[model samples]
Target: MNFRARGVFTLILGSFFVSGIAGLVYQVVWTRYLALFLGHTSYAVIAVLAAFMGGLALGNAWLGAKADRVTRPLLFYAGLELGISAFAAIFPAYYDLVHQAFLAVVRGLQPTGILRLSLQFIFAGLTILVPTVLMGATLPALTRFVTRSLAELRGKVAALYAINSSGAVLGVVLAEWWWIPSLGLHLTLFIGAALSFAVGLVALILSRRVEALGDGVAPATVTSEPAEQFTPRQLRLAVVAIGVSGFVAMLYEVAWTRLLALALGSSTHAYSLMLATFISGIAVGGWLVYRWKRQAHTLAAFAVAELVLAFTLFVSLWFYDLLPWWFVKLAALLARSDPAYFLYEWLQAAVCFGVMFVPAVCLGTTLPLVSRV
Candidate 1:
């Protein structure tokens, strides 16, 4: 690739890595650490996860809607970096404070279960909203930075998505195997925050240079028909499909974990494996979409994959305990003879392949179609 191409590619890849680590820190490390310290009540962890995702979706929608008017995308990124840094720097202290507060509440009036749960939800929501919202703006901002033409936009977007997903896989492996276990959650968050800040600084400097070289011309904005212009039926269909696929994929993943946990008689490990598998599937699906050329056919293929994924989830849910006798016997034998970590790992792989692959393929294909429209 030429120099500009190379530069854009590097930025995308670096952002991918940083964003991936940030997500891992939140989803895997922070959630586990908080639950461990705060008690595993669904009120605590699930509330936090929902808050983060909700903030992320809202942030993405906001950024995408106003992307064209944003003259200083780098500044937004810098703010994200600063926000993350502040959050990380305070995490240890904040957790301690929250824990102390929880204890005080328990001691004082002895709140009902519902009241405690409400408190947990509020606390979790405030703690996670900032970083998640910042992260949500990233892809749209990066898309604005890298895209130079309507024709090339889809490929550029796909490349960035693929790199980020790949980074997510690495982040999961590293966080689980090394960071959380060795460095601890606080330090891991700090490291991720530092990386995010560094990337922002670099992007800021580079963007300045690009502006200088352009002799005052700003970066080109994405060309799309205004919202006031009615979207054609095909475009509407594409958007609906993408949204539906994404929602179903997330549901399938959660269901898969619950099913596996029940079958395997282990909840925590089964959940982790499901998450890792789903992330890996997204990475693989992204790469495949990046390589695929025919947009219309790609969409069709993705639709088929979504159907398969839905079928798989339905079957798994319906057949929750009906595994062949030999399979259960084999599991029991392995559990008796050795640690059953391998079983969870294998199940994780199966779940990853089934749950992640199809919807990811479908989602990946949608961007290209939208860009084409």
Candidate 2:
């Protein structure tokens, strides 16, 4: 690669690393922190995490709509990174205050369990809303930075996603093996904040260089042949369908671990395994979709994938109770012998991976197709 290409690749890679660390911190640390402070009965932590993720989706939609209008997409993304870092720095204090406020309200009203849970959800949502939204804005913003053509757009987006997901997998492993034990919860947040800020600075600097070289201008619009023309409704439908598919795939992966844990009567470790498998599946799926470029039909593929996912969920639910005891016992024995927790965990992961594969592949195919339209 040339100098400019190398710089852009480095920027994307750094952003992926930062994103991975941030995701890992939230997944492994935040929930435990909340549980410790609010008692194990608090489902508020999960609620907060969910709200954060939802906020990210909203941010992506909002930022993407205006991506073409933004003169300095890198600056906007950097500002978001800084903002998220600042929040991470003060999250402990903010969370404690919110927890106390919740308790005081509960004491005054003597609310039922459901009411308390509602309050917890609200508190969690409030704490994570801004940062999560900001984090969500980065992907589309970065997409604009990296892509120059419709065909390149799909491959670039897929590559970036694979890089980011790989970072997340590493982050999860690091959090469990190093961050939580060595740095503790608060320090882990600070470490993630530092990484985010560093990545933002690098991206901003590289963007400035591109602008100075006159390489930042929008690519000239190509005249479409009559056969290539698409109605606005079709264009909008395609974009919306792809976005929805992406969101659904993410949500299902998020919830799959808990569902598996309930089925196996085991610890959350099984769920963690499922998450790892799902992310890996997405990375692999993106690669395969890119390789099978000519065979991809973005919308049709997405619908079929969604249907398959639904079927898988139904099968898992239906068969869970009827699973033979010997099979479960043998699986557990294999899991115990495997140092990486491969066997039992992989089984759970396989189910989650099956649910994730189709939608991810479909969504991966959509980016280039939609950009072309």
Candidate 3:
């Protein structure tokens, strides 16, 4: 990359990183707030994730379809960031209002479990849909804005995703270990808002500068690359496979989370550690994609990764059966130790890592590879 290309890449990467941190901050706090309102059940977690991911899927495809058409995508990205910041600033209050409204409406009717869960999901979905959709658009907007040449497009997208994933790792750790503990959810939300607003302003300024630089020049071309040169039927099949991959990945994540809670004590720190490890694996996978993009075969690598992931999932059951015996042995070994609880927590985290890390890493590789396709 030349100096100017490198400069633009750096700015895009940094902007996305800031946005990623703010986005995760909102996710962490909002999910906790929703859990409180809806009751801390497995269904509640699923509801929140479904709402969030549903918004993302819609927004990603919606914005991605239009991203390349805009002459100044950075300005569009700036608008999205600013809007998300505004939403974050008011979300806690909005959530409370929505929760109260839901309760009042359901007071006369003792809804069944399934009905109640559906109601809760609707309320949560309304609360998060707008901001989360905007969050989902960031990748496409940045990808569109940063790719000045066809040769650099794949690498640019991969690198941007890797940077954002790395930032999410930081966000998860900080929100768990520091932000929620130190600032509380309300304050943390505002802090995230500030970060997001800052990114918006920076993007806006950069957009104007770039526009001026290209004042007399022809517009930069945007390529509309299809997933791959497959028959329409094959393309349809690939889409179905991608959907299945997403579903199975989320299913495994939910299962692994519950398993971790069982093996480790159901402590906040334990949950945080598990989440952090999962995100770290994603960051590693994105980095690998960017670092080895030239050598990577999207379909072949994804297929092998999926097979390995399935094997790991099966093998994990055998390890799960052994956990009780090992925990018993560890507890007995540390019976007289003052920091026995701490030691056990660490061991539990290690076990969780061992069981989930390889699969999570494989799951991570799928994103950038799919992006290239």
- The top-ranked prediction according to lDDT is 3
**Candidate 3 or 2, higher lDDT:** 3
Which stretches in model 3 have alpha-carbon errors above 4 Å? Answer: 215-237, 265-268, 328-345
Q: How many pairs of residues collide in each model?
A: 0, 0, 1
Models 1 onward score TM values of 0.81, 0.80, 0.89
Whole-model lDDT values for every prediction: 0.62, 0.63, 0.76
**Candidate 3: worst 10 consecutive residues by lDDT?**
214-223
lDDT of 2 by residue, 1-373 (tens): 4565766667666686667667666666666665554465125335645776788778887866566467776666667777777888888888888878877988898877787767767766776777787778877777776666664565556666667777777776666557877888888878877877777777677677775465653442343422244577977887787677667665665555445555443333444455566656666655555464442455455566557656766666666454445346556566346554655655655655555455454444445444444
Off by over 4 Å in 2: 1-3, 37-45, 64-67, 148-152, 217-229, 243-247, 263-268, 314-318, 322-328, 331-373
Model 2 vs. true fold: TM: 0.80
For candidate 2, the C-alpha RMSD (Å) to the true structure equals: 4.2
* Superposition error at 130 for model 3 (Å): 1.4
Candidate 1: give the clashing pairs. Answer: none
Q: Deviation in angstroms for 272 in model 1?
A: 2.6
Candidate order by lDDT, decreasing, is 3, 2, 1
The list of candidate 1 runs beyond 4 A from truth reads 41-45, 64-67, 98-110, 215-231, 264-269, 295-302, 315-319, 323-328, 331-373
